[model samples]
Target chain A: MNFKMSVVVRTVADIMIIPIIVFGIYLILHGHLTPGGGFQGGAVIASATALLIVAWGTLKDNKDDFSTMESTGLTMFFLLALLGIIMGFSLFYNSLAGTGGIFGGTVSGINPGYINTGGTVPLMNIVVGLEVVAALSLILYMMAKRSDALEVEE
Target chain B: MLYYILQVLVLIGLVSTAVAVIWFKDLISAAIALGASSLILALQFYLLRAPDVAIAEAAVGAALTTAILIFAIKSTDRTEGYK
Candidate 1:
């Protein structure tokens, strides 16, 4: 089956990809302060993956890499959650808040929002974003590959 | 007034596209219609003050879902039922 689209599509996709990736990253990093978070940002990123597949078909089979990345994200998220419990707080507790950790930096007064004020929330967002991106992209890639192997029914 | 009118128009568009999904004989057309409906729904979500859901819907519902559906259709048949 001819999987590739016209030259117009390929060119547009190539040009549009950078902005989409940047926007997805923006959503992930600003998740603590904005209306979007890990899942949303990851979805946006995965949409880019979908666009690429639609335009040029699956370029490379990265199923194993995606699986490893997904596992790594999930494991890190779990470990980070566990850290809260070890610090004498409940599960998923905000232990790093006001403790002056990397993400626990404090602000003086009613500031808009210090990027560092989210404590473990930002870390959670990061890990969750990683897992979601990997998981969704893998799903798309697998589906595309499976479709390729199928014989079109008459 | 304008807000209410805009909402009404969006809702109308959403409904029409959804109906088009079912009305179309071509599977590809249905998938494209579904994508249009989902995009309109995303706009409705934004109008309802849920930007987060709007973003999610636009990304997943409108883009990814359509692509996946098209992929599925291509593997099977473009027309619904009967060769």
Candidate 2:
């Protein structure tokens, strides 16, 4: 059965979800310079998933997609760590720092912070963020679906 | 000064909300109280200069936890413990 909230809630969710997702991305991208990082930004995006479930009810499908995304993110994270070791650095090492390449600039003084100055930090942040978002969203979706199924059975 | 006063007030609110969560017989009220407590705790984290913790606490604790609890509550009894 299709279950949805009131028009007002749906409208609010429609308007608010995009901004929430955008803010989460911003947090993930600027994680090295900002206070928030992968876990926090991912939690923010997962909260958006909660909002969507609340407004639109249980999603009919797409559970597999979330699971796949989660797996892919974690795999990429591990691969990056392995790459670090192959490059003669320790596992999870920040090898690209100050190399004058992409994500290699250095912020020497007190400044506003550069977008590409965090080396491997920004990449790890994005990878971990994706994994967290997918995992938490999957949990939320599963819980919602189960609850809905029980409701329909009763 | 004013900052300390605000902090104290927020702490008081946080404690009271925790107590409310324990005291409520209605599970939904307890869940909502828990969400409020989480929100206040996030504010406290911000005041303590931990914006990362504050944001995560707000999003996961206040928002998602409350939503999950509400959904779980819908599938079962609303009263505390056994009827």
Candidate 3:
């Protein structure tokens, strides 16, 4: 089905996108202490990507955009994980920001009390979120686009 | 006592749903049943105090994965079984 939007509707959709992205970030940031974390928050962010693909008509036809973004996200995640490993820590390690304390909070690299204390955890969260968003958006967009094409062909 | 009962009920639900998914005739229905099983498992995860895994399972296993399967079902013939 062709989904056409009025200018006002498009404007509203555009305006709503930012809050969803920000909320995903917030979930990821407070993930360690709360009920949510990297995978969940990443999936939430991916949902926004899917929303954007649906709301923005350009994404429906642009196969290159989705593929490039998916590859870039995957590459960035792997590189970040590698960096964590190379910096004198295990792969996907949480402590790498040195052993300095953040005032009343726990030490930056070692120990562990503050939400932002993890060296690679926050970075990993961001990387995973990016990958998840890109991959999921691409998959959804491809599915929708293919279905539409198949319908037209039939 | 009640908590134990609830846990047992959830476990039974999970196992039954999984078996149904495996033994069901229709692939689409099986996928949906699998998603239901994932939701049940996620609930169990929450009950077991692993909220992170629970949330991930609910979102990916139940929602995103099921959506993908539904799309696949729409794209392919309904009568074909695991080729």
Interface RMSD of each: 1.4, 1.8, 2.1
Count of backbone collisions within predicted model 1: 0
Model 3, A1-154: lDDT tens digits are 1364677767776887788678778777777556776668777766665555445543646567757866776787787778657877777654455455531234534444567465556666766676677677677777756744575543
Which candidate's DockQ is highest? 2
Q: What residue runs in model 2 are displaced by over 4 Å at the alpha carbon?
A: A151-154
| DockQ of each candidate relative to the true complex | 0.67, 0.72, 0.39
Candidate 2, residues B33-63, lDDT tens digits: the string is: 9999999999999998899899999989999
TM-score of the first chain alone, every candidate: 0.91, 0.92, 0.68
User: How would you encode candidate 2's per-residue C-alpha lDDT over A46-138 as one tens digit per residue?
Assistant: 998888888898665888999999999999999878877989988988788888888999998799999989888888899999999999999
lDDT of 1 by residue, A26-129 (tens): 88888877788888899999998988888897859788999999999999999999988899888898888888868888767567877887888888989999
Alpha-carbon deviation at A135 in model 3, angstroms:
1.2
Measured by TM-score, the strongest candidate is: 2
Superposition TM-score, candidate 3 onto the true structure: 0.71
Query: Residue A139, candidate 1: how far off, in angstroms?
Result: 1.0
**Candidate 1 DockQ score?**
0.67
The TM-score that candidate 2 achieves is 0.93
Candidates 1 and 2, the one with greater lDDT:
2
Error of 1 at A135 (Å): 1.0
